[model samples]
Target: MKIFRRLLSYLEPYRIFLIVSLGAATISTLVALGPPYLVKLLIDQVLIQKNLPLLNYIILGLIALYLLHSGLTTLRIIYVNKVQQGLIFDLRNEVHHHLQRLSLSYFEKRQSGRITSRVINDVETLQAIVSSGAVIFTIALVTLLGSLIILMRLNLKLTLLAMIPMPAITFLVVMFSKKAHRRYRQMRRRLADINAILQENILGIQVTKSFRREKLREEKFIHKGEGYYQANMSVIRIWSVFFPLIMFASALGTVIVLYYGGREVIAGNLSIGGLVAFVSYLGLFYAPINQLNEVNNIFQHGRAAGERIFEVVDTIPEKEKKKAIIPPSFLKGKVEFDKVSFTYEKGKKQKEVLHQVSFTANPGDLIAFVGASGSGKSTIVSLLPRFYEINSGSIRIDGYNVKDFKLGYLRENIGMVLQEPFLFDGTVIQNILFGRPGASKEEVVKAAKIANAHNFIRQLPEDYETEVGERGVKLSVGEKQRITIARVMLKNPPILILDEATSSVDSEAEILIQEALEYLMKGKTSFVIAHRLSTIRNATRILVVLEGKIVEEGTHQELLEKESVYSHFYQMQFKENGKIIAI
Candidate 1:
């Protein structure tokens, strides 16, 4: 009931259409019940009593009733369709806005395929239920009740006999409802698995082809597809059993009526016309029972879809970025991690990833953080952008705690270049324009030149208009990295985060990108997360982060003199790469 109400709430703005649909539904059901009763009246009153003129009047009345039913049913269908479409539009937008507001952690925890399935498949399923199944259910109820009231008035004993199969029919329907619910749940789950397979394979198609693992991928896809097929077949098998059984139950009621009512007429206790009317009403009674059974199928499947969609739409967005909205202009970045500790928790306090750690960076300073893999280097930088919140402490920018400030301002003022840069499937110009939406063409060209991307972009057939393809696959790693740099350069924020920005690309490309990086870091508070030591030579300060804490902090020259963790890490990189990076 709650899910149904939630679904209806999506139609709140279109209440006028819903009301018209309801009125049509009510009139439609009433008119549809007319033919059977008119048959009963024709038999008992007109034919048996020899009222010829009355018979003609009832025949015309029956025709008018049928026409009214058809017209109202058509109107009801049309109006309900408008409401369903409106609900779908509103529900999709609501879910989309909710997703957009959620923090990055929510996305990190859930599968993209699962979320996409809910927004697309689930909404479609619910719309079908609302537009068709729900109205049918309402009609079945009205028809069932109206036929019963009239039938009972005609012959009490025959009506009682006719109802003998109803309890059994009801029992069978209840059992089918339970089975169908479970089967539909499995079917939906299988659908999600199939969606996951498709999403992963397509997104990672390059990797599969590069590794020559096409056969393996094909087998895996087939396996997921088979599971979905099996799930559907399982539901079909149950329906084949239950739907036939329901039809038989309705047929059983007719048999009872014909047997008992036939004897009554033979004995002269009931007339032939009276038996005919009883037969008509009994058929009307069980006809709705059959439709009601079909309505159950829609109920079960729609419920399954609703549950999945609600799981996301009902979730509370991560508190990491749920702060107030801040305008872009008020942001001036001077970042500080004040004893900020984070733990990827597993049940209370049983598992923790980071201990209390602290650091500060003033405006225009370049801060370099060095660490081995899983030593929490990336995690520390991630906090400054409010990707994840501190478990115990706070992060601040320009003396205002990040938690207290609007999440928009904290992130908008912080430009980031990740290790694996992502470019949308669009022209080079569009990707750069993403960083600064309103940037003029001249500003974009200037930023491209500074990032060492303008020369190569100009050489392409379409110049700045060249399509990057999916994740910038059309471009080489070096070209993609330069484009990322150009994007951040165009933004021109007060703070910069370079997460292994020079990790990819050839040695020659590295040198070219290094010059560009130097230009980007000028007069901005920057944090460089790097395993390679060469990139941090000109940093104002270097911090060795380990196991979620700052183990050592000093200048590159000072760290070289100490022979501690910093000196040891520097020497290790120098030996492996055959060069001293920060000398």
Candidate 2:
């Protein structure tokens, strides 16, 4: 109920439309009751009494009543649809906005499919509750109460007898409701699992095809599909048993009315027309009960979906402190990390990934980090942008702590070119412009030239407008890297972090990308995490990271003179290839 109420609060903006829709629904339901009364009037006054003069008027009245009902029903649908669509638009935007504010650690612990399901599929399920379910339930309640009053006025004794089976029906409905709620929740979870599996398979299709694991992937998807099938079947099983019992209960009420009312008519205590009207009204009463049962089914399904959606909406978003400062412009690229420590918490265990690490870089300095895998090289740079908050010490940019600056301003001034560059499904021009949306076309072209991407882009069929498929899959790795570098160059941030930016490209592509990086790093304070000894040979200071601590720091040649961890890594790379690595 709390979840449902929170969902309803989203409708506050469209309250006027909601009120109009409910009013239309109520009037339509009331008009619907007129038919039962009209039938009684026809039997008693026109047909049985043989009053030919009034027949035409009664028939015209009936037609007008139906027309009014149809008009109100149409209006009800339009207004309800407006309210439903408006609420969904607001809720989806809010959920997406919250997702953008979440830290990277949140994504690391969950599957992409599950998050996508909450954003898309689960929100879609809410249409039933918001659009039709609540309004229909209201209409059904009004119809049921109106029918009951009309039934009693026709014959109190018959009405009393007709309601005898209702208590048992109510008990049965309660049992079904409980079972349906649990089953629907289970079904939603299974659906999320299926979505997760499908998403994973689609994203990793290249790996699957490379390893020739098509059959294995198919089998895994089928396994997930089978679980979804069983969950749906469980709900179907409940409906199969519960609906028939409800129908039987409704039938028993009609039978009671017939048997008792037939005897009364023969006894001359009840008029024949009255008995007929009573039977029609009895059907009307049970109709709402059935509708209510169906509404309950819709409500249960929505409740399950709501739980999943609110789980995300209610999560604590990444904090943006109210008092945080926004830098007037980009910093001068001076970065200092003072005795910083960080621990990653996985479940109940805490593993410290970075020890007391410290480093500093002046403006126009190229600082390179060389370390084995999992030695906290990437973690150190990630902290510079405050992607993850440091545990112990202050990371200062210029003179202010990184935490003191507004998150957006801090990140906007730091450009990053990751090892795996991600591009949206768009044209080359669109991807480059993503760095700075306000950049002019001439600026984009100039940035591409600086990254050595302008020639290849011009060679493409559409020039700059050529589409880069999902994650830039249509382009080669080198092409994707150069475009990303172009994107950063356009942003022109004062501080740059390159995470093995050219590690995955071929030899020829690497040379082109290296040249591009040299241009990008010309005047910025740059942090380079590299495995290739040749790439960082000219770095102003080389920081040899070993076991989450900087064991050595100096210019490349100065570190080599000490024969420390830096020299050992340099020897491993160049001596293995039988080449004297230039420094």
Q: Pick the lDDT winner.
A: 2
- The candidate scoring highest on TM-score is 2
**What is the lDDT, from 0 to 100, of the residue 23 in candidate 1?**
80
Q: How does residue 99 of candidate 2 score in lDDT?
A: 91
Q: Please count the clashing residue pairs in each candidate, in the order shown.
A: 0, 0
Residue-level lDDT tens digits of model 1 in 9-89: 776787888878878887888787677667767877876777889888898998899889889978898999898888888
Instruction: Give the TM-score of each candidate.
Output: 0.91, 0.95
Over 4 Å off, model 2: 471-473, 578-583
- Measured with C-alpha atoms, the lDDT of residue 524 in candidate 1 is 90
Model 1 lowest lDDT segment of ten: 320-329
Q: List the residue pairs that clash in candidate 1.
A: none
Please estimate how well model 2 matches the true structure, expressed as its whole-model Cα lDDT. 0.88
Q: Looking at model 2, which ten-residue stretch has the lowest summed lDDT?
A: 574-583
Q: Each model's C-alpha lDDT?
A: 0.82, 0.88
